[model samples]
Target: MRLGSLIETKVGLNTRELKKMSNVTYYLKKFADNDLLLGYRPNSSKVSCNDEFVTAGDIVINSTTNEATIVSPLNEGKILTQSSIKIIIRDTQQLDLWYLCYLFNGSQFIKKQIYSLVEGTVLRRITQSNIQDLDIPVISLEEQKRIGESYRIFMVRKRLRIHREEEEQKAIFNFLEKKITYVKKGNKDEY
Candidate 1:
Protein backbone atom coordinates (compact mmCIF):
# COMPACT_ATOMS: atom_id res chain seq x y z
CA MET A 1 0.00 0.00 0.00
CA ARG A 2 1.14 3.56 -0.61
CA LEU A 3 2.11 5.28 2.64
CA GLY A 4 -0.05 8.26 1.74
CA SER A 5 -3.15 6.13 2.07
CA LEU A 6 -2.12 5.14 5.59
CA ILE A 7 -0.78 8.36 7.10
CA GLU A 8 -0.97 12.15 7.13
CA THR A 9 2.21 14.23 6.95
CA LYS A 10 3.13 17.68 8.29
CA VAL A 11 5.96 19.74 6.87
CA GLY A 12 7.96 21.75 9.40
CA LEU A 13 8.38 25.50 9.67
CA ASN A 14 10.48 27.17 7.03
CA THR A 15 13.96 28.49 7.94
CA ARG A 16 12.71 32.05 8.40
CA GLU A 17 10.07 30.86 10.86
CA LEU A 18 11.83 28.43 13.13
CA LYS A 19 14.47 30.33 15.07
CA LYS A 20 16.50 29.99 18.24
CA MET A 21 15.02 32.20 20.98
CA SER A 22 12.09 32.13 23.42
CA ASN A 23 11.09 28.51 23.59
CA VAL A 24 7.71 27.54 22.31
CA THR A 25 8.89 24.06 21.40
CA TYR A 26 12.24 22.47 20.77
CA TYR A 27 13.06 22.38 17.09
CA LEU A 28 13.80 19.26 15.11
CA LYS A 29 16.05 20.26 12.25
CA LYS A 30 18.30 18.63 9.75
CA PHE A 31 21.73 17.22 10.81
CA ALA A 32 20.10 15.72 13.89
CA ASP A 33 22.44 12.84 14.66
CA ASN A 34 20.24 10.36 16.49
CA ASP A 35 16.54 9.60 16.81
CA LEU A 36 16.03 12.71 18.98
CA LEU A 37 15.39 16.33 18.15
CA LEU A 38 18.44 18.48 18.94
CA GLY A 39 17.59 22.15 19.48
CA TYR A 40 15.04 24.76 20.60
CA ARG A 41 13.16 27.58 18.91
CA PRO A 42 9.87 29.42 18.59
CA ASN A 43 7.48 30.33 15.80
CA SER A 44 6.83 34.06 15.47
CA SER A 45 3.13 33.38 15.19
CA LYS A 46 0.75 32.49 17.98
CA VAL A 47 0.32 29.01 19.39
CA SER A 48 -2.20 27.84 16.84
CA CYS A 49 -2.89 24.17 17.67
CA ASN A 50 -1.52 20.78 18.59
CA ASP A 51 -1.03 19.74 15.00
CA GLU A 52 2.07 21.90 14.77
CA PHE A 53 3.71 19.98 17.57
CA VAL A 54 5.17 16.50 17.32
CA THR A 55 5.08 13.79 19.94
CA ALA A 56 6.70 10.44 20.45
CA GLY A 57 5.83 7.75 17.90
CA ASP A 58 5.83 10.37 15.17
CA ILE A 59 8.35 9.76 12.38
CA VAL A 60 10.67 12.49 11.05
CA ILE A 61 12.41 12.36 7.69
CA ASN A 62 15.33 14.44 6.47
CA SER A 63 16.27 15.13 2.88
CA THR A 64 19.98 14.93 3.68
CA THR A 65 19.78 11.52 5.30
CA ASN A 66 16.78 10.31 3.38
CA GLU A 67 15.92 8.30 6.46
CA ALA A 68 13.00 8.20 8.86
CA THR A 69 13.46 8.20 12.62
CA ILE A 70 11.00 7.73 15.46
CA VAL A 71 10.70 10.72 17.76
CA SER A 72 12.20 10.09 21.17
CA PRO A 73 10.23 10.69 24.36
CA LEU A 74 12.46 13.66 25.23
CA ASN A 75 11.04 15.57 22.28
CA GLU A 76 7.35 15.23 22.92
CA GLY A 77 6.53 18.90 22.41
CA LYS A 78 9.16 19.74 19.82
CA ILE A 79 8.43 21.47 16.52
CA LEU A 80 10.25 20.88 13.28
CA THR A 81 12.09 22.89 10.64
CA GLN A 82 11.68 22.64 6.86
CA SER A 83 14.60 20.22 6.83
CA SER A 84 12.44 17.59 8.46
CA ILE A 85 8.92 16.36 7.81
CA LYS A 86 6.74 14.78 10.47
CA ILE A 87 4.67 11.77 9.56
CA ILE A 88 1.57 11.06 11.58
CA ILE A 89 -0.21 7.76 11.40
CA ARG A 90 -3.94 8.14 10.95
CA ASP A 91 -4.83 4.68 12.25
CA THR A 92 -2.80 2.88 14.85
CA GLN A 93 -4.91 -0.26 14.50
CA GLN A 94 -4.12 -0.68 10.83
CA LEU A 95 -0.38 -0.12 11.00
CA ASP A 96 2.52 -0.14 13.45
CA LEU A 97 4.38 3.18 13.55
CA TRP A 98 7.67 1.78 14.75
CA TYR A 99 7.68 -0.91 12.11
CA LEU A 100 6.94 1.71 9.50
CA CYS A 101 9.89 3.76 10.75
CA TYR A 102 12.13 0.69 10.60
CA LEU A 103 11.15 0.15 7.01
CA PHE A 104 11.78 3.77 6.10
CA ASN A 105 15.20 3.79 7.73
CA GLY A 106 16.27 0.39 6.44
CA SER A 107 14.01 -1.12 3.83
CA GLN A 108 15.68 -1.48 0.46
CA PHE A 109 12.50 -0.74 -1.46
CA ILE A 110 11.91 2.61 0.24
CA LYS A 111 15.58 3.48 0.20
CA LYS A 112 15.75 2.72 -3.48
CA GLN A 113 12.92 5.10 -4.22
CA ILE A 114 14.32 7.82 -1.98
CA TYR A 115 17.81 7.50 -3.45
CA SER A 116 16.40 7.74 -6.91
CA LEU A 117 14.56 10.93 -6.10
CA VAL A 118 17.55 12.58 -4.37
CA GLU A 119 20.20 11.14 -6.70
CA GLY A 120 21.25 14.17 -8.71
CA THR A 121 19.86 16.98 -6.64
CA VAL A 122 22.24 19.49 -5.07
CA LEU A 123 20.43 19.49 -1.71
CA ARG A 124 19.36 15.86 -2.08
CA ARG A 125 16.00 16.85 -0.74
CA ILE A 126 12.80 14.99 -1.45
CA THR A 127 9.28 16.35 -1.59
CA GLN A 128 6.59 15.28 0.86
CA SER A 129 4.69 13.70 -1.99
CA ASN A 130 7.60 11.36 -2.66
CA ILE A 131 7.44 9.92 0.81
CA GLN A 132 3.66 9.87 0.77
CA ASP A 133 3.63 7.90 -2.44
CA LEU A 134 6.13 5.23 -1.34
CA ASP A 135 5.00 1.67 -1.81
CA ILE A 136 5.22 -0.36 1.37
CA PRO A 137 4.79 -4.03 2.00
CA VAL A 138 1.72 -5.06 3.92
CA ILE A 139 1.79 -7.46 6.82
CA SER A 140 -0.63 -8.60 9.51
CA LEU A 141 -0.99 -6.36 12.55
CA GLU A 142 0.38 -9.12 14.79
CA GLU A 143 3.43 -9.47 12.61
CA GLN A 144 3.99 -5.75 12.54
CA LYS A 145 3.83 -5.56 16.31
CA ARG A 146 6.40 -8.29 16.69
CA ILE A 147 8.72 -6.69 14.16
CA GLY A 148 8.32 -3.29 15.73
CA GLU A 149 9.10 -4.61 19.19
CA SER A 150 12.22 -6.35 17.93
CA TYR A 151 13.32 -3.24 16.07
CA ARG A 152 12.95 -1.19 19.26
CA ILE A 153 15.05 -3.70 21.17
CA PHE A 154 17.68 -3.66 18.47
CA MET A 155 17.97 0.13 18.65
CA VAL A 156 18.36 0.04 22.41
CA ARG A 157 21.07 -2.57 22.21
CA LYS A 158 22.85 -0.70 19.46
CA ARG A 159 22.87 2.49 21.53
CA LEU A 160 24.30 0.64 24.55
CA ARG A 161 27.01 -0.93 22.42
CA ILE A 162 28.04 2.39 20.96
CA HIS A 163 28.14 4.01 24.40
CA ARG A 164 30.26 1.17 25.69
CA GLU A 165 32.69 1.50 22.81
CA GLU A 166 33.01 5.25 23.36
CA GLU A 167 33.69 4.76 27.05
CA GLU A 168 36.31 2.15 26.29
CA GLN A 169 38.07 4.50 23.88
CA LYS A 170 38.03 7.31 26.40
CA ALA A 171 39.55 5.07 29.04
CA ILE A 172 42.25 3.98 26.67
CA PHE A 173 43.14 7.57 25.82
CA ASN A 174 43.10 8.61 29.49
CA PHE A 175 45.45 5.82 30.44
CA LEU A 176 47.75 6.70 27.57
CA GLU A 177 47.78 10.32 28.71
CA LYS A 178 48.70 9.25 32.25
CA LYS A 179 51.49 7.02 30.98
CA ILE A 180 52.88 9.81 28.81
CA THR A 181 52.81 12.22 31.76
CA TYR A 182 54.63 9.72 33.98
CA VAL A 183 57.29 9.05 31.36
CA LYS A 184 57.86 12.78 30.83
CA LYS A 185 58.19 13.61 34.55
CA GLY A 186 59.50 10.37 36.12
CA ASN A 187 63.01 8.80 36.42
CA LYS A 188 63.59 8.07 32.71
CA ASP A 189 62.17 9.85 29.67
CA GLU A 190 60.60 7.29 27.33
CA TYR A 191 60.62 8.65 23.80
Candidate 2:
Protein backbone atom coordinates (compact mmCIF):
# COMPACT_ATOMS: atom_id res chain seq x y z
CA MET A 1 0.00 0.00 0.00
CA ARG A 2 1.21 3.51 -0.68
CA LEU A 3 2.25 5.31 2.53
CA GLY A 4 0.31 8.39 1.43
CA SER A 5 -2.90 6.46 1.77
CA LEU A 6 -2.23 5.77 5.43
CA ILE A 7 -0.89 9.07 6.72
CA GLU A 8 -0.58 12.83 6.24
CA THR A 9 2.94 14.19 5.73
CA LYS A 10 4.16 17.77 6.01
CA VAL A 11 7.48 19.56 5.59
CA GLY A 12 8.85 21.45 8.56
CA LEU A 13 9.75 25.13 8.99
CA ASN A 14 12.76 26.75 7.34
CA THR A 15 16.07 27.61 9.01
CA ARG A 16 15.68 31.33 8.52
CA GLU A 17 12.36 31.41 10.38
CA LEU A 18 13.59 29.13 13.14
CA LYS A 19 16.50 31.51 13.76
CA LYS A 20 14.18 34.44 14.14
CA MET A 21 12.09 32.86 16.91
CA SER A 22 12.90 34.18 20.38
CA ASN A 23 12.55 31.07 22.53
CA VAL A 24 12.80 28.41 19.91
CA THR A 25 12.68 24.91 21.30
CA TYR A 26 13.58 21.48 19.91
CA TYR A 27 13.73 21.27 16.12
CA LEU A 28 14.07 18.08 14.07
CA LYS A 29 16.06 17.90 10.82
CA LYS A 30 16.85 15.28 8.22
CA PHE A 31 20.65 15.61 8.47
CA ALA A 32 21.62 16.79 11.89
CA ASP A 33 24.84 15.69 13.60
CA ASN A 34 23.22 16.34 16.98
CA ASP A 35 19.71 16.44 18.42
CA LEU A 36 17.65 19.47 17.42
CA LEU A 37 17.65 22.33 19.95
CA LEU A 38 16.14 25.81 19.73
CA GLY A 39 15.22 28.75 21.94
CA TYR A 40 11.61 29.89 22.48
CA ARG A 41 10.21 33.37 22.70
CA PRO A 42 6.68 33.50 24.10
CA ASN A 43 6.15 37.09 23.08
CA SER A 44 7.71 36.86 19.66
CA SER A 45 5.41 36.69 16.67
CA LYS A 46 7.85 34.35 15.00
CA VAL A 47 6.61 31.57 17.25
CA SER A 48 3.28 31.54 15.46
CA CYS A 49 4.73 32.35 12.05
CA ASN A 50 4.74 28.85 10.65
CA ASP A 51 1.61 27.17 9.32
CA GLU A 52 2.68 23.67 10.38
CA PHE A 53 3.32 22.97 14.06
CA VAL A 54 4.29 19.55 15.32
CA THR A 55 2.04 18.04 17.94
CA ALA A 56 2.11 15.00 20.16
CA GLY A 57 1.93 11.62 18.38
CA ASP A 58 3.52 13.00 15.23
CA ILE A 59 6.23 10.76 13.84
CA VAL A 60 9.28 12.84 12.97
CA ILE A 61 12.18 11.61 10.86
CA ASN A 62 15.47 13.32 10.11
CA SER A 63 18.82 12.46 8.49
CA THR A 64 20.65 12.23 11.81
CA THR A 65 18.27 9.88 13.58
CA ASN A 66 17.69 8.04 10.29
CA GLU A 67 14.52 6.77 11.91
CA ALA A 68 11.12 7.94 13.00
CA THR A 69 10.37 8.62 16.64
CA ILE A 70 6.98 9.53 17.98
CA VAL A 71 6.88 12.99 19.48
CA SER A 72 6.16 13.24 23.18
CA PRO A 73 4.36 16.27 24.56
CA LEU A 74 7.70 17.61 25.80
CA ASN A 75 8.72 18.19 22.20
CA GLU A 76 5.24 18.94 21.00
CA GLY A 77 3.73 22.17 19.67
CA LYS A 78 6.98 23.26 18.04
CA ILE A 79 7.47 24.35 14.46
CA LEU A 80 9.80 22.19 12.44
CA THR A 81 11.96 23.25 9.52
CA GLN A 82 12.00 21.89 5.97
CA SER A 83 14.90 19.63 6.85
CA SER A 84 12.55 17.08 8.43
CA ILE A 85 9.26 15.38 7.63
CA LYS A 86 6.31 15.17 10.01
CA ILE A 87 3.86 12.31 9.62
CA ILE A 88 0.47 11.86 11.19
CA ILE A 89 -1.45 8.65 10.84
CA ARG A 90 -4.92 9.07 9.35
CA ASP A 91 -6.60 6.07 10.91
CA THR A 92 -5.35 3.92 13.75
CA GLN A 93 -7.53 1.04 12.62
CA GLN A 94 -5.99 0.80 9.15
CA LEU A 95 -2.33 1.35 10.11
CA ASP A 96 -0.36 1.13 13.32
CA LEU A 97 1.65 4.26 14.02
CA TRP A 98 4.45 2.55 15.89
CA TYR A 99 4.74 -0.09 13.21
CA LEU A 100 5.07 2.55 10.54
CA CYS A 101 7.82 4.34 12.46
CA TYR A 102 9.87 1.18 13.00
CA LEU A 103 9.48 0.07 9.42
CA PHE A 104 10.57 3.39 7.97
CA ASN A 105 13.51 3.72 10.32
CA GLY A 106 14.77 0.16 10.55
CA SER A 107 13.61 -1.81 7.56
CA GLN A 108 16.19 -2.14 4.80
CA PHE A 109 13.39 -2.48 2.26
CA ILE A 110 11.92 0.84 3.30
CA LYS A 111 15.34 2.45 3.28
CA LYS A 112 15.90 1.23 -0.28
CA GLN A 113 12.55 2.61 -1.27
CA ILE A 114 13.42 5.99 0.19
CA TYR A 115 16.93 6.03 -1.25
CA SER A 116 15.60 5.27 -4.70
CA LEU A 117 13.46 8.40 -4.50
CA VAL A 118 16.04 10.65 -2.86
CA GLU A 119 17.29 13.62 -4.92
CA GLY A 120 20.21 15.90 -4.29
CA THR A 121 23.60 17.02 -5.59
CA VAL A 122 25.45 17.76 -2.33
CA LEU A 123 23.09 16.52 0.38
CA ARG A 124 20.53 13.84 -0.31
CA ARG A 125 16.96 14.90 0.40
CA ILE A 126 13.74 12.92 0.47
CA THR A 127 10.83 15.17 -0.27
CA GLN A 128 7.35 14.89 1.26
CA SER A 129 5.97 13.64 -2.02
CA ASN A 130 8.66 11.02 -2.26
CA ILE A 131 7.85 9.69 1.17
CA GLN A 132 4.14 9.71 0.47
CA ASP A 133 4.63 7.66 -2.69
CA LEU A 134 6.73 4.90 -1.12
CA ASP A 135 5.23 1.45 -0.77
CA ILE A 136 4.40 0.03 2.66
CA PRO A 137 3.61 -3.58 3.45
CA VAL A 138 0.21 -4.06 4.94
CA ILE A 139 0.25 -6.24 8.03
CA SER A 140 -2.25 -7.28 10.64
CA LEU A 141 -2.83 -4.59 13.23
CA GLU A 142 -2.09 -6.98 16.09
CA GLU A 143 1.23 -7.96 14.61
CA GLN A 144 2.10 -4.35 13.95
CA LYS A 145 1.30 -3.39 17.53
CA ARG A 146 3.51 -6.17 18.81
CA ILE A 147 6.38 -5.12 16.60
CA GLY A 148 5.92 -1.50 17.58
CA GLU A 149 6.04 -2.42 21.25
CA SER A 150 9.30 -4.28 20.73
CA TYR A 151 10.80 -1.33 18.90
CA ARG A 152 9.78 1.01 21.71
CA ILE A 153 11.52 -1.18 24.26
CA PHE A 154 14.67 -1.31 22.13
CA MET A 155 14.75 2.47 21.93
CA VAL A 156 14.47 2.78 25.72
CA ARG A 157 17.43 0.48 26.22
CA LYS A 158 19.47 2.34 23.62
CA ARG A 159 18.85 5.63 25.35
CA LEU A 160 19.86 4.21 28.73
CA ARG A 161 23.12 2.87 27.29
CA ILE A 162 23.98 6.19 25.71
CA HIS A 163 23.25 7.97 28.99
CA ARG A 164 25.48 5.62 30.93
CA GLU A 165 28.38 6.12 28.53
CA GLU A 166 28.02 9.88 28.75
CA GLU A 167 28.10 9.76 32.52
CA GLU A 168 31.22 7.59 32.53
CA GLN A 169 32.99 9.99 30.23
CA LYS A 170 32.02 12.90 32.46
CA ALA A 171 33.43 11.12 35.50
CA ILE A 172 36.69 10.38 33.71
CA PHE A 173 37.04 13.98 32.65
CA ASN A 174 36.38 15.21 36.18
CA PHE A 175 38.97 12.85 37.67
CA LEU A 176 41.59 13.97 35.13
CA GLU A 177 40.84 17.61 35.77
CA LYS A 178 41.32 17.22 39.52
CA LYS A 179 44.50 15.19 39.12
CA ILE A 180 46.02 17.73 36.71
CA THR A 181 45.22 20.59 39.04
CA TYR A 182 46.77 18.75 42.04
CA VAL A 183 50.02 18.15 40.13
CA LYS A 184 50.18 21.76 38.92
CA LYS A 185 49.74 23.02 42.51
CA GLY A 186 52.45 20.64 43.84
CA ASN A 187 49.94 19.26 46.35
CA LYS A 188 50.61 15.53 45.85
CA ASP A 189 51.77 14.34 49.29
CA GLU A 190 51.72 10.53 48.79
CA TYR A 191 53.31 10.52 45.34
Candidate 3:
Protein backbone atom coordinates (compact mmCIF):
# COMPACT_ATOMS: atom_id res chain seq x y z
CA MET A 1 0.00 0.00 0.00
CA ARG A 2 1.11 3.52 -0.64
CA LEU A 3 2.37 5.22 2.49
CA GLY A 4 0.39 8.32 1.65
CA SER A 5 -2.79 6.27 1.85
CA LEU A 6 -1.89 5.09 5.31
CA ILE A 7 -0.59 8.32 6.85
CA GLU A 8 -0.86 12.11 6.80
CA THR A 9 2.16 14.40 6.75
CA LYS A 10 2.41 17.92 8.17
CA VAL A 11 5.09 20.59 7.98
CA GLY A 12 6.19 21.90 11.33
CA LEU A 13 6.74 25.52 12.38
CA ASN A 14 9.84 27.36 11.23
CA THR A 15 12.53 28.56 13.63
CA ARG A 16 11.71 32.16 12.82
CA GLU A 17 8.15 31.77 14.08
CA LEU A 18 9.31 29.73 17.05
CA LYS A 19 11.83 32.37 18.06
CA LYS A 20 9.01 34.92 18.12
CA MET A 21 7.24 32.97 20.84
CA SER A 22 8.01 33.25 24.53
CA ASN A 23 11.29 31.49 25.41
CA VAL A 24 9.44 29.60 28.10
CA THR A 25 7.79 27.42 25.45
CA TYR A 26 10.12 24.51 24.70
CA TYR A 27 10.61 23.70 21.02
CA LEU A 28 12.36 20.90 19.09
CA LYS A 29 15.28 22.18 17.01
CA LYS A 30 17.06 20.17 14.33
CA PHE A 31 20.81 19.30 14.31
CA ALA A 32 20.90 19.44 18.13
CA ASP A 33 21.91 16.41 20.22
CA ASN A 34 19.08 16.93 22.71
CA ASP A 35 16.56 16.88 19.90
CA LEU A 36 17.84 13.47 18.78
CA LEU A 37 17.08 12.05 22.22
CA LEU A 38 13.50 13.33 22.06
CA GLY A 39 14.57 16.33 24.11
CA TYR A 40 13.49 19.93 23.64
CA ARG A 41 15.19 23.21 24.39
CA PRO A 42 13.95 26.75 24.95
CA ASN A 43 13.37 28.68 21.74
CA SER A 44 16.46 30.66 20.80
CA SER A 45 16.44 34.38 20.07
CA LYS A 46 18.13 33.76 16.72
CA VAL A 47 15.96 33.36 13.62
CA SER A 48 15.84 30.00 11.78
CA CYS A 49 14.93 29.15 8.22
CA ASN A 50 13.56 25.67 8.94
CA ASP A 51 9.85 25.06 9.55
CA GLU A 52 8.43 22.09 11.43
CA PHE A 53 5.97 21.31 14.23
CA VAL A 54 4.87 18.15 15.98
CA THR A 55 1.95 17.01 18.13
CA ALA A 56 1.35 13.68 19.81
CA GLY A 57 1.99 10.53 17.76
CA ASP A 58 4.04 12.44 15.19
CA ILE A 59 6.88 10.41 13.63
CA VAL A 60 9.78 12.68 12.76
CA ILE A 61 12.64 11.88 10.36
CA ASN A 62 15.52 14.31 10.47
CA SER A 63 19.28 14.80 10.23
CA THR A 64 19.58 14.71 14.00
CA THR A 65 18.13 11.27 14.48
CA ASN A 66 19.08 10.27 10.91
CA GLU A 67 16.11 7.97 11.28
CA ALA A 68 12.45 8.12 12.25
CA THR A 69 11.43 8.58 15.86
CA ILE A 70 8.00 8.95 17.37
CA VAL A 71 7.30 12.09 19.37
CA SER A 72 4.77 12.83 22.05
CA PRO A 73 4.49 16.59 22.30
CA LEU A 74 4.17 17.79 25.88
CA ASN A 75 2.03 20.78 24.93
CA GLU A 76 -0.09 21.90 22.04
CA GLY A 77 2.22 24.80 21.18
CA LYS A 78 5.49 22.85 21.00
CA ILE A 79 7.01 23.28 17.54
CA LEU A 80 9.64 21.30 15.59
CA THR A 81 12.03 23.20 13.41
CA GLN A 82 14.63 22.30 10.75
CA SER A 83 15.05 19.19 8.57
CA SER A 84 12.12 17.40 10.16
CA ILE A 85 8.99 15.83 8.68
CA LYS A 86 6.05 14.91 10.85
CA ILE A 87 4.08 11.79 9.91
CA ILE A 88 0.75 10.83 11.39
CA ILE A 89 -0.91 7.50 10.72
CA ARG A 90 -4.30 7.93 9.17
CA ASP A 91 -5.93 5.06 11.01
CA THR A 92 -4.56 3.17 13.98
CA GLN A 93 -6.63 0.14 13.07
CA GLN A 94 -5.28 0.03 9.55
CA LEU A 95 -1.66 0.71 10.41
CA ASP A 96 -0.33 0.24 13.92
CA LEU A 97 1.69 3.21 15.16
CA TRP A 98 4.42 1.19 16.80
CA TYR A 99 4.63 -1.12 13.82
CA LEU A 100 5.11 1.82 11.49
CA CYS A 101 7.81 3.25 13.72
CA TYR A 102 9.54 -0.11 13.82
CA LEU A 103 9.42 -0.36 10.07
CA PHE A 104 11.03 3.03 9.63
CA ASN A 105 13.65 2.52 12.28
CA GLY A 106 14.42 -1.18 11.90
CA SER A 107 13.21 -2.72 8.66
CA GLN A 108 16.15 -2.79 6.25
CA PHE A 109 13.90 -2.82 3.21
CA ILE A 110 11.89 0.15 4.35
CA LYS A 111 15.02 2.02 5.38
CA LYS A 112 16.51 1.47 1.95
CA GLN A 113 13.35 2.81 0.34
CA ILE A 114 13.40 5.86 2.58
CA TYR A 115 17.07 6.63 2.08
CA SER A 116 16.67 6.20 -1.64
CA LEU A 117 14.71 9.43 -1.58
CA VAL A 118 17.59 11.41 -0.16
CA GLU A 119 18.73 14.36 -2.25
CA GLY A 120 21.64 16.84 -2.07
CA THR A 121 25.41 16.51 -1.77
CA VAL A 122 26.42 18.16 1.51
CA LEU A 123 23.03 18.03 3.25
CA ARG A 124 20.85 15.18 2.10
CA ARG A 125 17.15 15.63 2.66
CA ILE A 126 14.03 13.53 2.16
CA THR A 127 11.10 15.25 0.58
CA GLN A 128 7.65 14.93 2.08
CA SER A 129 6.34 13.60 -1.20
CA ASN A 130 9.01 10.90 -1.22
CA ILE A 131 7.85 9.72 2.18
CA GLN A 132 4.24 9.76 1.08
CA ASP A 133 4.91 7.94 -2.16
CA LEU A 134 6.72 4.97 -0.66
CA ASP A 135 5.10 1.55 -0.44
CA ILE A 136 4.22 -0.24 2.80
CA PRO A 137 3.31 -3.83 3.35
CA VAL A 138 -0.25 -4.49 4.44
CA ILE A 139 -0.24 -6.83 7.37
CA SER A 140 -3.16 -8.39 9.17
CA LEU A 141 -4.54 -6.41 12.10
CA GLU A 142 -3.64 -9.19 14.55
CA GLU A 143 -0.12 -9.45 13.18
CA GLN A 144 0.31 -5.70 13.27
CA LYS A 145 -0.81 -5.57 16.89
CA ARG A 146 1.63 -8.31 17.82
CA ILE A 147 4.51 -6.55 16.08
CA GLY A 148 3.56 -3.23 17.60
CA GLU A 149 3.43 -4.71 21.09
CA SER A 150 6.84 -6.29 20.64
CA TYR A 151 8.28 -3.04 19.40
CA ARG A 152 6.91 -1.20 22.43
CA ILE A 153 8.52 -3.74 24.75
CA PHE A 154 11.84 -3.41 22.97
CA MET A 155 11.78 0.36 23.30
CA VAL A 156 11.05 0.10 27.03
CA ARG A 157 14.00 -2.22 27.57
CA LYS A 158 16.28 0.01 25.51
CA ARG A 159 15.38 3.06 27.59
CA LEU A 160 15.82 1.12 30.84
CA ARG A 161 19.29 -0.03 29.80
CA ILE A 162 20.33 3.51 28.94
CA HIS A 163 19.05 4.79 32.29
CA ARG A 164 20.85 2.03 34.18
CA GLU A 165 24.12 2.77 32.40
CA GLU A 166 23.86 6.47 33.19
CA GLU A 167 23.20 5.73 36.86
CA GLU A 168 26.20 3.40 37.04
CA GLN A 169 28.44 6.01 35.45
CA LYS A 170 27.30 8.61 37.97
CA ALA A 171 27.93 6.25 40.88
CA ILE A 172 31.44 5.47 39.64
CA PHE A 173 32.22 9.16 39.19
CA ASN A 174 30.95 10.01 42.67
CA PHE A 175 33.02 7.25 44.24
CA LEU A 176 36.14 8.40 42.47
CA GLU A 177 35.50 12.01 43.48
CA LYS A 178 35.16 11.06 47.15
CA LYS A 179 38.35 8.97 47.10
CA ILE A 180 40.29 11.76 45.40
CA THR A 181 39.09 14.28 47.97
CA TYR A 182 40.04 11.99 50.88
CA VAL A 183 43.55 11.45 49.48
CA LYS A 184 43.99 15.20 48.86
CA LYS A 185 43.03 16.03 52.47
CA GLY A 186 45.35 13.33 53.84
CA ASN A 187 48.34 14.80 51.91
CA LYS A 188 47.56 18.39 52.93
CA ASP A 189 49.91 18.10 55.99
CA GLU A 190 52.80 17.03 53.70
CA TYR A 191 52.33 20.21 51.61
lDDT per residue (tens digit) for residues 16-42 in model 3: 866786754444443222333433222
lDDT of 2 by residue, 1-191 (tens): 99998877777767776777776665654212122211111221111223466665566777433467665556666777777777766777777666887787778989999888888867777788887888988889999978877776676667677779999999999998988888889886653
lDDT of 3: 0.63
Candidate 3 collision pairs: 12-52, 12-53, 13-52, 13-53, 14-51, 52-80
* TM-score-based ranking: 1, 2, 3
Query: Model 3 — TM-score against the truth?
Result: 0.76
Q: CA RMSD for every model?
A: 5.9, 6.6, 7.3
TM-score of each: 0.82, 0.76, 0.76
**C-alpha lDDT score of every prediction, in listed order:** 0.69, 0.67, 0.63
Report the Cα lDDT for candidate 2. 0.67
Per-residue CA lDDT of model 1 for 1-191, tens digit only, reads 98899887778877566665356765545323456322122222122235556665567777567767766556667777777777777777777866886787768888897777664446778778888888888999899878877776777777778889999999999999988888878748553
Could you tell me how far off, in angstroms, the CA of residue 21 lies in candidate 3 after the best superposition? 3.9
Give the candidate order by descending lDDT. Answer: 1, 2, 3
For model 2, the stretches where C-alpha displacement exceeds 4 angstroms are 14-26, 30-51, 63-66, 187-191
Per TM-score, the best of the predicted structures is: 1
